[model samples]
Target: MASETIPITVEFTGGLEMLFADQRKHSLSVPAKDERGQAVTVGWLVHYLCVEVMKDPRKEMFVLDGHVRPGILVLINDADWELEGEASYALQARDNILFVSTLHGG
Candidate 1:
């Protein structure tokens, strides 16, 4: 196993920038082995993101849109895919994904 850097862009809802300011743009390296000597890959990172998003209570707001339940946008490398397609998107060694909130603010 080898180590490589993966670039990611995390988009936030309007006025929610402060929440993710520290992690707006990051270049994380997937180590060859974890503490238990397990290999890490981009797929693992994507799964982690999905889990994390759902863990936050605010995530409901994105889906509900204050009234209706329209799907939210999770762009991967500038492509919007709210279904399984989003996860299937191949992640390059250096790719960027902008997780934008689809709802508009007044």
Candidate 2:
């Protein structure tokens, strides 16, 4: 049986707002299954960039690279996952995910 299309909100940090918006409009394909053993659309995992940052313990080292970028906060709803459990948190239908950058300058 086919699954219903679930709507989800995705927010990006820093200058990624435009990129995230574009991503939502023409989302990439992803294989997801719903509650009833049916296939569903859950959009693409556009936050891989953040995941890469999390992988390294020496944050300063990774930060030096251009891929890391600024604004290092990604939240599921109002809760920042880094404080919660990072990407291990499972996404549900109609979830509002927000990503924001942390600012620090001298």
Candidates' C-alpha lDDT: 0.47, 0.46
Model 2: residues with Cα > 4 Å off, grouped in runs: 1-5, 21-31, 34-44, 47-70, 103-106
**lDDT, residue 22, model 2:** 31
Expressed as tens digits, the lDDT of each residue in 1-106 for candidate 2 is 4544555566654544433333322222223454555443211233333342234344442243533344556666678666655555555666666655565342
lDDT string for model 1 (1-106, tens) is 3444454545555434333443455454433443454543334554455445444445454334332135445666666654435444545555565555445565
- CA shift at 51, candidate 1, in angstroms? 7.0
Model 1 TM-score on a 0 to 1 scale: 0.48
Tell me how far the alpha carbon of residue 27 in candidate 2 is from the true structure, in angstroms, after superposition. 9.8
Q: lDDT score of model 1?
A: 0.47
Worst 10 residues of 1 by lDDT: 62-71
